[model samples]
Target: MFVRSLNNESQLLRKIAEGDQHAFKIIYDYHRRAVYARAIFLLKSEVLAEEVLQEVMLKLWQSAGKLTDETNLGAYLTTLTRNRSFQILRRRVLEAKTEIELRKDWTESHNETEEGILLADTQKILADGIALLPPQQKMVYELCRVDGLKYEQAAQCMNLSVETVKSYMKLALRSLRSYMKSHTDLAVILIILKII
Candidate 1:
């Protein structure tokens, strides 16, 4: 029975690689819930899980032409979903940590009367500074810092080359640093530096 199942998977994969929609549909139907569960387990967010599911299946379709054989189909798909789920989970965690640290700094550094005001002021100034950045630089920086995307992942999301993403990030940091240096006070400067 196990050998028969293996053979069936192999045949399905071959047809999938040859661009058979029914074969692809079978794979999708067989694996979609497992993939969703994997993403949800790692990401802990339904929205993120759904997004990961779409992303993983899209990647499977795109790479179907390169899939080598049926013997590895289950392993390959499982690994791919797991990896992508972990990646998204890690990014969310990093973003949450950064947000917590930023809030902690804001709270500890200022007394009650001034702390809220200072934080609000700084947030506005930072928003304005971000607005001044060039479109590509702003995008790269926001995706990395706010969305917690790594450079390579942001590049993929933006459909830009990785090298281009790196370049945009460098320029974005330079621009942000220059803007902050020109406009911010010492405490806000420290916070911005820490966040970056």
Candidate 2:
């Protein structure tokens, strides 16, 4: 029985070396369990283990012509599984180290300039909001808010009565408040992406 099995395996390997898909499928069915079991046991992650299994199978097919009658299939798969598992573990360690270093640098940079960045963002949003006002409202906002002029001063500069300037200022403030509120989410997203 053992001799018959050896002959079967040798024949399957020979056919796989000639690029026979049916032979490769049979070999895959016979060996996939050992490959997957070893990978899952070592990696402790089903997803990564499945990845290793596919990689090993692909390697096996690619290197099928190297197989000889005396080659031990189980041991060959074991070596491949162990090597690939270690590679994943090494990559994970490297990623963790990189993440830590990046976080440290980002935190330091953010701490030093976070307030300035936020103030700039707010000013931009406020400027955009002001630009959305009607021509008269926009003029009133620039004169009163941007230039720091009192309502009466703005009124004289625009050649209008004090009451009319006050009314325009109120309308501009209300419109700007609504515009700023609507744009808050966009500003927040920009800030978060920049920080990250």
The model with the greatest TM-score is 1
Instruction: Report the C-alpha lDDT of model 1 over 3-104, residue by residue, as the tens digit.
Output: 113457767777877789898788888877777887788778886877677778767777887776544666676788788888877887899999999887
Candidate 2: RMSD over Cα atoms?
Answer: 23.7
Residues 1-196, candidate 2: write the lDDT tens digits: 0112334877888899899989989888888888898889889998788778878887888888898888887788789889999999999999999999988777443453876777678778877777788999899888876666667667857999989999998898887767766777765645534421
CA error at residue 189 for candidate 1, angstroms: 0.9
Worst 10 residues of 2 by lDDT: 1-10
Ten-residue region with minimum lDDT total, candidate 1:
1-10
Score each candidate by Cα lDDT: 0.77, 0.79
User: Which residue segments of model 2 deviate by more than 4 Å?
Assistant: 1-7, 108-196
lDDT of 1 at 156: 71
Task: Report the error of model 1 at residue 8, Å.
Answer: 9.9
- lDDT top scorer: 2
